[model samples]
Target: MQTTISLEIQRYRPEQESEPVYQSYEVPLRKDWVILDALNYIKDNLDGSLSYRWSCRMGVCGSCGMMANGTPVLTCATFLETYAPGPIRVEPLINFPVIRDLIIDMSEFITKLKQMKPWIVREEEQPLSDGEYLQTPDQLTEYKQYSMCINCMLCYAACPIVGLEPGFLGPAAIALAQRYNFDNRDQGKKQRTEILKEDNGIYECTFVGECSIVCPKSVDPAGAIQRYKVAAAAEWWKSLLLPWGNR
Candidate 1:
């Protein structure tokens, strides 16, 4: 069996370099080690200047997301043995500006997420004495899958639309908007629809389905966008047919 592996990690220091470059480091190959483990080895032993993001090595925190051999993945969850006996290429998530090595800027994603209003909005707040807004098992199930998103930004990297149309609201944001839209206790669906129906919103998604395929959490963002399109079309037809009725 091979005793070691090589990782070609992308490096970028704006003050030092005008463009990103790859720097390679060799580390021990162990069956128990994941991609993050190799990265940690590089950071600690090989080169302390090597930079990346990671937390909760258990895969709960989405910070360890990176391009592993050209695929977007959570490094903590991807085992090194899967790409054994050779070099692995690691790069920052695409479709966003790289702040530094292995760390992409998330400001755009954050702005779009805020537009989704990823919380339960109410037309009228119920009194505290009225008790918490309750939901049944079925109601909880409606948005459970989307709620699993850890904001890893893997979906954004997998989405071609995000690369082409920089203004397009990426997959995770739309899926989260649907999460709140489906919640029984939320009254923010109407508000979210206004944003989603816009040019750079849900309509921009061409339904390539790669976003869902790469999602580590199984949050089917592509399906969510399609569902929203269907609903939006239906609403449009209804409004056209019944001019006098309240939408």
Candidate 2:
């Protein structure tokens, strides 16, 4: 007997339907196939109208994030064999407006990321003749872990704070902010601190911790956010105590 598995996918079409619906397909269950391969089979051979977003088949691009069996995961890296002898539910990442089938509108996420300014900020540009900004290995390690976020938004999907408070700056945005803030070369820590200290920023996170659990890259955004909170609190105290000094 041939092995097969059922894929129940959530689909949304704004033009034809007001709300989302589920569609099912059965595909060959191969040991080596991942969830993405099953989706491709459905698109190519079964249903052409079914829509979703994916770029690099490898895990690097992070474009294939989706909810598999009620958990946000990278489809490219989640193998079908894990969910073996049965049906699997696949849907768009939660906590965002669905654009179509599996693509969530990330315009808000992009805007928040921009607000954090996840880049090195210098008060003045250094001349090229001065040579590159140098960092020791210990300094590099400070921010390298948080720099692995690929903007997949899986963290957003898993974060309860995002679901409860739509305006909150989500995990990836805050983590990326810290990524730059930790860099010895970055001079924008004060600016980023002001932004993150806002009402809808890090304070909004209740630390349910689902964000870190769902991250495919193991970025540990939850840890970064907590660390940032500590720094922000310390800065606030310093400002209060030494108003005469440049804190």
**1-247 per-residue lDDT for model 1 (tens digits):** 7999989999998899999999998899999999999999988888998888999998688999999999999999998889987799999999989999998899989999999999999999999999999999999999999999999999999999999999998899999999999999999999999889889998999899999999999999999999999999888898899978876
lDDT of 2 at 143: 97
- Would you give me the overall lDDT of model 1? 0.93
Clashing pairs in 2: none
> In order, what is each prediction's RMSD in angstroms?
0.8, 1.1
**Reference-based lDDT, each prediction:** 0.93, 0.93
Q: Give the range where candidate 2 is weakest over 10 consecutive residues by summed lDDT.
A: 238-247
TM-scores of the candidates are 0.98, 0.97
Residues 103-189, candidate 2: write the lDDT tens digits: 889999999999999899999989999999999999999999999999999999999899989999989999999999999999998
The alpha-carbon lDDT assigned to residue 137 of candidate 2 equals 99
Model 1 residue 199 CA deviation (Å) reads: 0.6
Error of 2 at 230 (Å): 0.6
